[model samples]
Target: MSDAFFSEVTGRIPYAGLDSTDPLAFKVYQPDRLVLGKRMEDHLRVAVCLWHSFNWPGSDVFGVGTFDRPWLDARLDPLVAARAKLDAAFEFLAKLGVPYFCFHDRDVAPEGKTWADTQRTLETVIDQIAGRMEQTGVRLLWGTANLFSHPRYAAGAATNPDPEVVAVAAAQVRSMLDATKRLGGENYVLWGGREGYETLLNTDLAQEETQHARFLAMVAEHKHRIGFKGMLLIEPKPQEPTKHQYDYDVATVRGFLERHDLAGEFRLNLEANHATLAGHSFHHEVAAAIAAGLFGSIDANRGDYQNGWDTDQFPNSVDELALALYEIVRSGGFGSGGFNLDTKLRRQSLDRTDLFHAHIGAIDTLARSLLVAAALIEDGELERLRAERYVGWSGDLGRSILKGDAALELLSVRVLSGDIDPRPVSGRQEMLENVVNRAIWSVDRAELAAIGTPVGAAGRG
Candidate 1:
């Protein structure tokens, strides 16, 4: 399809239109055409999460504040700067060939007014950015509601102990859903990082879980009645501020949605860092969600167990990403969804755009990984060699051979002779090495230097 038509239909450009040498009005940027399958816009949109948008020291007040005053002031300048950043980011994304974005509520309304007034501001911002998004061929994956924003819910929001607090949380969700619909969002996501408890004392698990389910059901019903077309994405995080969270993993969320009859309309936006935090491979989580037919979205990032919760680092590990790429490549390449860089910047980085380069580098690495994996799989001998290397030595065959010709044959060197060649398998590994090694050799370093790279660059613009 034409890029414009594709953009209109999916609210994004198709994978093919990502690279245009026909020169637009923005900086000259072109992502390496590595992953030969499709463009980020056409294949599946890549989004930047707004969790790290503010670039402020005191912005976490939305999560830990007693009052919203200080947080509001920090938001103003960052957002004004962010709008410009958004333009640049879109230009960068367009050049990278990825399209579509998932916006957090705070990206637009970072404590400028009352909760109600902030909601209105969100609506206005969406309207304002809609044109620019169209120009850049980016579409909305959805909008997020900051459920962990208020201190009134030190316990939780929808799952709070207080009935009044739960009511307010639901009300905000309803409004946010409306805002999503108004902006032509494709889906809405909820990440209940604060829904679980650090202590069992005075905690009513049944009541809280039930209330949370009821809140989701109500939101679904309300949106259904209004004929809202967007789906809902429920992301799972193990724990952070609280010792345990309600939607701790995909299985937990799957069970909750099933019990609440939200399994169909609500799907999982599985974040890689969350999976790593939960002690599972990120690719395994993606595969699990896909197997359950609930793989709706992705929050792409990495984490380290040695650190605190929500580390939000880039997925730069090669082997981990190779496995992930293999899983998705074999599954037809992220069928109908997108990847959102759910990353953040620490107090360390002074430059904002450095975060952008880091994200770009991470994505480029993954793209290369995917390409190498697909090549290995299609090479015709790697899979058979791997199977022979593994399955022949273990399982029932190893135990069943007692003491006859069979046992003698098992010990026989002839049995291990040549079901698969080790040479080709070595070549596959070497091929992967070459693919990764050549990633940088293909880069035009001189061109990058000409761009006048900025400093203190942080945040995935």
Candidate 2:
């Protein structure tokens, strides 16, 4: 396959070829034929979480004390420069070839602005931004409900013990959902940053979870009433600002959704950094969601154990990286969802361009990984090996699966099974090496030249 094959998915030409002026909405690359067994550039809509850039001045204070003093100080110059700062932020993202962006409502709210005033002011700002987004074909992925902002929410938000505070949290999310629809956003994210408790003696887990579900149900009802056609992406973090949150992991959240019968309206926004914080592989996190049929969106950020908490570093590890791509490939590729980079820069000195570079590099790496995954899946080797590994299984369900039958048939067979090696015939390390190398070679000649000549080009000559 060659560039001709790439045209199949990305149209007859790359997205860049569609409208050169609005590069932000279509920054895609043609894959090297060597990478994805077929020549194709998987067109993806990438987004940067606005929190990373808009709140850079407060990087040093993350995981520290409350921002009541510095943040609420209406006299501060930077605080007063909210609109100008946001304009610059949007312009910056636009130049990076990113069309979609996510933000927290609190991040853009004017200092000392009452919650009601914030809502009114935000509508005006979003209307302006929406026009620009429409012109550029960019859209918001909806902002988060920063329930953590109010001291009143110190206990919790929707799950707060105080009924008034709980109502406030729910109302805030309702406004956000409405704002999201106004901006033509396709989805909303719930991070649950302040929905946990430190002591069992002081909190009620059952009430919290129930109220949280009620809150989501009402939001869904509101959307239905308004005829909104977007999804609610629930991001699961094992631990963070709160210890042991209700949506602690993918499995927990998946179960919650099923029990509440809200699985159809909500899905997981798996975050690599959040997964790492929970001591699990990011790939594993996505795999769980995929298996449960609830995988919705992604929070593209890398975490480091040494960094402490959710670092939101750009993804770089080859293993975790490949898994991320493979998970998407197995799911048959995303259609219209955006890759929201839920990350932040702790280093205050890092320039705006540096953030762009990090996003560019990470996205490019994942694109290449996607190529490798397509090859592996298309080769039929993975499925073939798995089938052979389960040959002659005693369990009826296992036998059925090995015999190319339905999985549900084995519900009757408990431990009646033969020993089947779960390991793949080929190691993942070797698989990734082959995939990455092939991807590198498949990049277009123009991109290759721009990145400097291939390492062994002299020999090719």
Candidate 3:
């Protein structure tokens, strides 16, 4: 708003077609473009993550902060720096033209000495941020508590052995929930960053689980008490800071919800990288949650296959994303959920303008993936094949089996008397892969035509 935080990056990013040479322009993410009877913006609902974009200092375990972000300079007063970061964050979102943004309590403000002081600081900074959101029309996607970053939470937050620490964590969550509600956030996320133990010797597994359940119950009760019209989302990460997290994956979280009777109050905010970390593909995670009727939001990012840890890299794989988006679309798209870019700039990408490049690339990648997915669904070949594969279920025997009318003894008698033997069918995996590839190529050709570029002249690389 005030002379753009990234002054070098001029103009609002436009959908300049795939042939355009401008690095900052989007190649496929046309906000108003119709895809499956909905505008791209409505279908994707992309949101910028304030923590990664504004608060992360490019510091990793191997190194200190290498990026010279002015707002992160230690010399500035914490509150003043917080305000500056918020200003830049809002400016970035406005320039990117994304409809929504998200943040953590500590991301928007400095954590002070006392709980009261921290609350005051967060409220003050949130007031400033609220004004900016009003001016720019950028809505809050969600807000969360930074329960894992501080040293006090090293042992764990909700699953900590110490009741005092757990109580403190509860208070922080309460404040964050209030802030999220006040800012009109559509959802609230609870990520189990350090909610697990490093070793069994030092942990009481059953006790820890009880504490975790109580903590979530308290949050759900507060949500009802405050009348916050936002869905509560639990992000499943197998592990990172902790050895093994309770919310290991979509299936694990669903079980926990049912165990604690919180299924109605909480749904999942599935992260792409987290899915990979849990030894599952991104589509698998989305589909699992969708099947359970618990899929709600997404932390849209990717992880390195070579590395076992969560790299949080911006997603670039078209095939992978196309499949993931297909699952999201099949689930009827997000209800209260949206695609929040929970990604950060690579350490080498130190320039402030790199932020624009990173976001633009991710946006285009997802847009293209959506186009391919929609084409696949509209063509109906894949769905038709899948349904045909299960066509046996339409028969009387299959119906009897599914309806619990076929007992094992009756099935054995029928099989023995009829001398029945099942024959295996080829899965045709390679052919299915080719089908997807053809769909992707079809979308690519259309994009080339829109850009007026010859297929041979346009280099994908």
Model 2, position 70, has a per-residue lDDT of: 30
The model with the greater TM-score, 2 or 3, is 3
Arranged by lDDT with the best first, the candidates are 3, 2, 1
TM-score of each: 0.70, 0.77, 0.97
Q: Candidate 2 at 336: error in angstroms?
A: 3.9
Winner by TM-score between candidate 2 and candidate 1: 2
| lDDT winner between candidates 1 and 2 | 2
lDDT of 1 by residue, 201-268 (tens): 97989998899999888888888977888778888989987799888888888888888788977888
Q: What is the lDDT of residue 399 in candidate 3?
A: 100
lDDT string for model 2 (1-461, tens) is 11121122221223342124442223334433333343443334567776665654533553442221232344655434555555656555555555688887776764245767776766766666676676556577656667786788877787888889988888788877788888878788887877788789888778888988888898778889887788778889887788777788899998899999999988888888888877788888988988898887887778776786877777655455655766776677655465777766546434444554466566655565554555556666666665666564767755766777754435334324633334545446576456545543543443445447564563352
Model 3 clash count equals 0
* Candidate 1 structure lDDT: 0.64
For residue 13, model 3's alpha carbon misses the true position, in angstroms, by 1.2
Least accurate 10 contiguous residues by lDDT in model 2? 1-10
What is the Cα-based lDDT of residue 373 in candidate 1? 53
How much lDDT does each candidate structure score?
0.64, 0.66, 0.90
